[model samples]
Target: MSTLTVILLSIISLMYSCKDNNTAQSEDIKEIKSSEATTQLSPNTTTTKDTISIDKSTKTNTFTSSPLDLLKQNEKAIVTLFQEASPSVVFITTSVYQRDYWSRNVYEIPRGTGSGFIWDEDGHVVTNYHVIKDASKAEITLSDHSTWQAELVGVAKEKDIAVLKIDAPKEKLKAIKKGSSNNLIVGQFVMAIGNPYGLDHTLTTGVISALGREIQSQARIPIRDIIQTDAAINPGNSGGPLLNSSGELIGVNSAIYSPSGASSGIGFAIPVDVVKWVVNDILKYGEVRRPVIGVSMVAENYTKGFGIEKGALISSIFPDSPASKSGLQGMTNSRLGDVIVSLDDKEIKNNTDLILALEKYKPGDKVKLTVLRNNKEMEIDLTLGSSN
Candidate 1:
């Protein structure tokens, strides 16, 4: 072992060690590339993706997907849903007549725009009553951009539901698949399909914020059993379908609790259960066919007044009406009226309660009404009839 020989031996050992280190680094690089090939970003996050690996040729880091595609599953499901449901959703435009100030000529002007859904293969479109309210003419535009004149079929203003018939071909019409809202739970995934702000076939996704909600319609009637969601429902989204994850129609987008008429994360919808009955009745009888007691009740919430804390008072009975035929007396100018206490043994606390109870029955159904008249309680048996 001379000095030169020893130095040569040490250099050879160092070379071997360097070779081993280089091989290890090469293996590590291969493993890193393999891991990158199989990596999947989180679905819940939409943040910007960091630079993954630098390319020696390009001298810059390359990214695989956009921040938007982080939630690929949710996005794919929404896209599929829109494809299936968008055809069922239709755009609605209403027109009203107005007299010009200068020309004094009556002209039909576009009143408002809204959204609706096809109810059946017969081309019955369902929308909010206010959407076509006071409109002398209306037009429905399908997803394929074909416009058709709509004929008014039936309407339930209290429920804010209106059915319009279009003579669209069956091949062009797609009826929405109905789902029951009776089993909905809060926080479940929901999607809204509509034309919001005149945007056609817009899809907004959210969770069910609440259920069994109540809302007032333009006709001053309380629409009960509403479904509330955070989906972005705006001005033109009215009467559109609110769907569950299965692309089933759960509710109809009716109103929003926004200050600026924009989506403030609070939107209301009429449940499908109510729409089911309302539409069925409309198809059968051309209207809701709700039984009328044929007694005039004071307007402006008279049933909730201080004089009569509860019970719907009979203001006046129409001649040849069920009440008139049953010899029911109405209130006069100087005295009080017959306050309806109960119907069919159901407790009627106020006029709204009476209306709701009556909604459970149809025209020509026999019902017993217990009334408080002249400080005495009496039962009156009357066969329900149409209000005409």
Candidate 2:
């Protein structure tokens, strides 16, 4: 072959080899791209060679925030809840129409002014029973400067709760968010929204001082499980809502344990549980069906060292009474008294324990009682009788 022909033939073979290598590299790159796309599409199918994972050792980090940061974050929410709930809280003033003793004519006298909250869209307002006691006329003033004559729907003296209805427009009614009092604890944040001393829509904040407190209503009935707060509650704050931070009504501001008729940093509220029970019974039956076990007993102190040092000393059991039928052993000679020690496996420290145990059960229910008679412990079952 000639020199020019050999050089041309060598160049053609080199060009063919370079083209083949390029084609193979392109195919390999395309396959790799396709495999990457598949892996991206199905991430679950992608697994690591090692099955066990170890903890990643990363640099420690700390977060620091200002005290006002939390307040700034929640201020708007808190304001919104207060503004929405304030309208539901109404100011109530009562007037009583009494006939002159000598004239025998009718005249109206202002009783008192207090706070209340709309219970429903039906214009039913709930307030302290003492607020409207002896009042023949009640005026309910809404947040919008609208007024309506209210009629008493129901009253629960024991709970110091009363329900009143106003013939107002449904659009004006704002019901409060009901909260559970069973979950309340000491030192939790509480807010009181009410018309204090006739100032409308006032908000006071404090912590729950205590729980399960006992107080006396104006009607002389003992209210149990009352919520104690130090939220600057005053005279006009009665019947107003004691709300949680979430703006849920936990209690009704009822009484303050102070020498002066002002906020002495100790205020009591009726728990929402009692309010619920009273309201439900009043709305359904027009009266409170208070369950009581009809039996009167002497105090253990009066019969000290007479075989009835503790527990309730059964003094008398009426004929055909539930106690009589339940075979509760009483003093047969009217001199030796049997001491009750426990009920339903619950130890009875004194008469208070017996009363507490009985309060937990309704009439017509059976309770097991453990008694101390002649220095011996004995158990007996007794059916509770109705108070009525």
Candidate 3:
């Protein structure tokens, strides 16, 4: 209990006091973080720092949301897009008149109803070709309830898209804000705005269910890179706008993979890229000029092995086709044919490879094709042909 002992005791007390202060500061920081976390704004809800209310009606307590909140915050953006695009969207109805064979009387039948959007102020409206198939008359009803008789401008059966024109005021045209479908990602929020079941301007929310979906159009040809969504799309929703969170038109609601004729939560849309291509062609050439190879072939199964064994077996090549000129052998034995093994330098695994490769070129573009003939690989160059 001398001066040195007293000084040592004082140092121990100061150390203990500092440790306690540090512990208190740590607890305060933790408390602040917890408060901040809870105070985060819920999406689609108008929550402020001064007044935060949790609605038990729409949201459950177990669901602490981050992306959900983001979706809610984007609800305004979805609504605005729908509202702005709604005016440009039109409800298309078709009428077919047929004569009753037994009664010898002609009757007007309501063919169908679908949705479409204004392409430009020139009165052109774009929609699904199936929406007006074999109809004797077509009509378009705007968001303002104004109805006009529409004339078919052009139709692209391959893309299942059609363009029509109506004699309406230029000022009434409201084209949707176009967006890139390539930028879409799976699980991102999307909204479908259309006339579902003839109910005009209906809005449904969903997320991108998948990408690069391939579906057969009304013409029974494969349409590629279709956007798949869980949005509640129905019969009348065809040709309507499928919008992104920013309210831009990313796709055109085209088909549904439902057996019930109603929404099974699986809907397909024509990607904006295809729509853009169709639109540009319809506006310029009044038709889609698809490229063709002018050759018929069967899909050769290749799971067993490679070589002439299986690939795209040439069935019949047109007399003046590029394939015929390139010396690509066709099936003369009715069962066996030369198999396409590669294009340029890329290996062709199946017919899909050849299909995808041809998409990159137009008519008259020469492409190198490697073929397997008599168990030996051979090369040939063929110029593409126009499907027109």
Candidate 4:
């Protein structure tokens, strides 16, 4: 061959070798990227990773778990809660007897239905007073679908709490675990299990929207220190237990703020603090024992008309009782009397204050009181008496 032909052939061979080397390097790089991306997906996945970039700002909070696995875990937790709590819940059906004018037959008429929870191993059911109120009798359906006739154990109508007892075996009764509602904060998660609208065990979830609400009881007494939640509470939900995420009983579902008488997202529950007190009292005293100071407070309007802005004015005093014997005087013909302004270290601004303060103590406990009598302030050490 010629010298120019030999030189050209060598240059062409060198160029072809470099091109092949570049292609091999490109294939090796592609294999490495494919291996790294394979860890993020399974064989059955069709999701595209290009648009699924993880934001670095949320790196600390980002989940490194498989979505399906996380979903399964959450579903397991919810199922466990329902299974653990449903045993403590019961369905209450109330009935009354009505006489037919035409038939002269006393037929059992169904009044309403509500929910309750077992309170103790003795098959004691705790529910709202208005639920079993005025009903001739009630039938309790246990979690096992066993029906039992319930007998009234005791009731606190002022607080709208009632207890019923069934003759079931201890193995059939599952008492709920109690939790505190006093330290609850807004936005904390809560769960409500009840028979809303008489549909068997229904579960609703929500958060504590607010706290320290007030509602009226069937006895016309004010129920204070209520916990407000967004949990759906309807008519049948009354007497059901309101629970925290841990499945502990925190409150008793009582009233709702819906104009249509349904779940309005504004539901009030009787705090467990009050429930504990009432349940203890009923189990001991057969009813709520109110501590009385033996003095009736003046009408709020009557006291306000005299330019008295604070304190509950004394209207009348039960003769020979704590207030009367303690030299406490009441309003005479001129509507002038002693005004209770404080009890111990707590301030009593109105009748509500006085009543609530009295609730903290039992009968025969000595309490110090500060009252305004005839525009003069004085302190009295009085013995608290019971209105039993």
Candidate 5:
């Protein structure tokens, strides 16, 4: 064999072997890519890390909890009380008629809002006098969401109470059960239901902080036997019922002592006992039948100017009146008139005292008056007359 032929043969064989090796390597690479694609497309297959994560996510987290406790006795009582009493509560909104300057058209504009309650089946609603004060008309919204126009029945300004009549059906009216305030004691629980700040049917609970409290009415007359409570009474709570533990109306929420015009835990209510008589008189006569002494009393300032420290000074006596029949004298330019120092053994410090004392009596009732005449105290008998 020739040397050149041997070298050529060896080079050709080495080239063919290298080509086959390259082809085999290409096939192996293609298989590896196909396997990777299959692994990615198969939903039944997962990597070890992925399987661990999937198993954790499928498990739900468990939590342990304590059982809820039932409501206490007082709590249950309050709930039941509210449910029974709230239906009798009503919301009152007052409006004033105004005439537009340019159009000259009269229309009603909202004035304010307050609370009231159904007084009887005849559709009589009772509320605070100040709530409807300066208002031309009012609307009463019952707890059942029925609204009705109300007419002014009567008012006792000195008592801070006003009665309104509605034309609603008797079936819709729910008269509140009345309770006695004369038997009420301090520290007894009281629940007040009203619309505070226009939020209807709001209930506030507190104990009677005091009894026999005195508060001024809208007419500046002193309202005796007022109820003081710690319940939350705001602007719109006026005229709502103050209920005792038995869910009976004991008083009517009237005023609150707060500098910021909000409840300060000091609230006042007109006792239901006083309310009964005042309401009866109003319903019967369209006005309070307060007994009249038929004598006009001078102002406090006028009495003070005359060196009178106390007692209600007689300003003038009406003709054919009770005072005239009793010979009660008035003050003259040179002499001080008779000043009532006492009435029926009750000290008459001022006109307010005299007025309050006379409230306990009815017309034609005889009363003894202690008068200061000519710097000497004397007694006189007089018969009370009805202003009605």
Candidate 6:
């Protein structure tokens, strides 16, 4: 054989050997890929080399929720209070009748909404006077979602309080327990339950921010001895109860001092002490039965015109009454009469002050009055008379 022929034979053998090695590498790669694909396709499959194993019994879809801790002492107390006192709270809705100009048909339109509470088992409901003011009809809804038509019983416009009667069963009516507001102190915790924004039975917690605060009623009368709180009182919270820690009503949530018409922490309530008498008088007389001093005081504007800026100026006295018998003089064409400066040592600043002062007493109750006559201060003793 020739040398060139021997070299050609060697090159062909090398090419065949290289092709066999490439085929072996491709088969090995296919086997390795098949194993990996099987591992991914079957999550339950296990491999000792990579040490990857998934238990079929283990569930990643099911969630195990953690337990919640128990409530704290104060939190539990508030919860209990809300549970007990909420039954007495009620939701109030008012409507006004409007006649369409074209159709000449009358229809009841929703006027507003507010909060209220049961006053007695006979279905007497208590709320703010402004809540039902100008309303032709009112309705009361109990905590159980039962609603009833409410009749207007009476209203103390000066105090911004009103009373309504419902025909609900005595079993459904839960009257709130009364608490004294005179003993309330600032920083004392209080809770307010109301239907804010038409949401029924909403609760808010806060403290009494101040005592003896004054607020004006819808009648433009100054409501004195008011309780100021930091509770979140809104427009619908008017007529709701302000309860103390014991779940007794200490005041009636009435107003908020906010420019945005929402709660800005400063809220006012009508003191329960004043509410007690006002409600009682309404139940009996259909109006507040305030004591009469048998004397007419000059309006604040007129008093200011006379240069009397800080006291109630007496305009006239009724004959054979408390003022006349006590020799309380009134304004004369010649000179000024007595300007009441104080009542029972309480300073009187205007006619409203004197009127509110007189409300603190009853008929035949003796009171001492300090008056300014001829620029000289003198004291007078008189017995109050009945307005009736």
Backbone clashes in model 2, listed as residue pairs: none
Number of clashes recorded per candidate: 0, 0, 2, 0, 0, 0
Distance (Å) between predicted and true CA of 316, model 3? 3.4
- Encode model 1's per-residue lDDT on 1-388: one tens digit a residue: 7999999999999999999999999999998975655454222223234644432444333467776767897688889988998999999999988899999999999898999999999999999998999999999999999999999999999999999999989999999999999899999999998888899899899999998789997767788889999999999999999999999999999999988878999999999999999999899989887788789876536555637766788889998889999878887878777888899899988777888899888789999999988878999999999754
Q: Mind sharing the TM-score for model 4? A: 0.81
Better of 2 and 6 by TM-score: 6
Q: Superposing all C-alpha atoms, what RMSD in Å does each candidate have to the true structure?
A: 9.0, 12.9, 12.9, 7.3, 15.6, 11.3
| Candidate 4 ranges with C-alpha deviation above 4 Å | 1-64, 299-309, 331-336
Clashing pairs in 3: 44-72, 44-73
lDDT of each: 0.89, 0.81, 0.83, 0.89, 0.92, 0.92
User: 2 or 4: which has the higher TM-score?
Assistant: 4
**142-210: candidate 3 lDDT, tens digit per residue:** 988999999988998878999999999887778777889877899999988889888999989999999
Tens-place lDDT per residue, model 6, 1-388, is 8999999999999999999999999999999997877756466555665675667775555354344323465688999999999999999999999999999999999999999999999999999999999999999999999999999999999999999999988999899999998789999999999999999999999999999888998888889889999999998999999999999999999999999999999999999999999999999999988888888878787777788879988889898888999999987889887999999999999888888888878988999999999899999998898876
- lDDT (0-100) at residue 227 of candidate 4? 91
Global lDDT for candidate 3?
0.83
Residue-pair clash count for candidate 2:
0
| Candidate 2 lDDT trough over 10 residues, lowest sum | 52-61
Per-residue lDDT of candidate 2, residues 250-361 (tens digit): 9999999989888999999998987887787777777666554445677656767664545777766678876677666566664455667788888877765676566677
Kindly give the stretch of ten consecutive residues in candidate 5 with the minimal lDDT sum.
49-58
Per-residue lDDT value at 323 in model 1? 94
lDDT of 6 at 331: 76
